[model samples]
Target: MKLFVDCKKAGHLCDKGQYEDASFFEKLSVRMHVMMCKQCAKYSERNAKLTKLLKDSKCKQMPEECKKRIREELARELAKKPE
Candidate 1:
């Protein structure tokens, strides 16, 4: 029920807000804190940019075959380790 939140809490809320995970009150608290705190404002701006960039980036996932090979290699290496 706390309307006012500290910088740390605001930052956490800001992160959650980016992912659409924060509730209405949480988002409101972050907006309120960011309005008065320049540092948090900048942090929120940069975080937003980062999130946008990542979302816009068409990243491809590694092939499952390649992942399976890597896992097999890791298991083989681990099995060679002395007890």
Candidate 2:
């Protein structure tokens, strides 16, 4: 595996790390990339902050049934409207 990753891959790895989903090598590569890239370092910092805030918030997801109902209602309403 490469010792370094690009900014895009680093960002992806950062997200995975946020959820504790990234493997050790992936995390290492991303960290190495961040160390070399100033922009990625900043991005990683913000991502970590966001992840911490989300975890602390104890937020819940809206049910899929409710989302489907909302979508169906919106579609019906849009269909009734004249363009």
Candidate 3:
């Protein structure tokens, strides 16, 4: 199987817990490839730094009522059964 050009990109997507998350084995394979490739290692370092900066920045907070309503809507949605 082919490996991803940037293992950090795979890790970033994996962190999001999204439906499109890459498989652990696929990421492990990419990590292995990166270990042997200097260019990929630098790319991974840059991506990691960017991710840290983005996560560290402050953002606006939602109001308490809005947060509660959003939670209730999510709970109701989660309770629904799939066809």
lDDT by residue (tens digit), candidate 1, 1-83: 68999999999999999999999999899999999999999999999999999899999999999999999999999899697
lDDT of 3 by residue, 11-54 (tens): 45434323335576666765776687776667656766776787
Q: Give candidate 1's TM-score.
A: 0.84
The TM-score that candidate 3 achieves is: 0.47
What lDDT does the true structure give each of the candidates? 0.95, 0.92, 0.65
Candidates ranked, most accurate by lDDT first: 1, 2, 3
Off by over 4 Å in 2: 81-83
lDDT of 2 by residue, 2-48 (tens): 77888888899999999999999999999899889999999999999
Candidate 2, run of 10 with poorest lDDT:
1-10
Clashing pairs in model 3, backbone N/Cα/C closer than 3 A: none
TM-score of each: 0.84, 0.72, 0.47
The alpha-carbon lDDT assigned to residue 16 of candidate 3 equals 37
CA RMSD of all predictions: 2.4, 2.4, 10.1
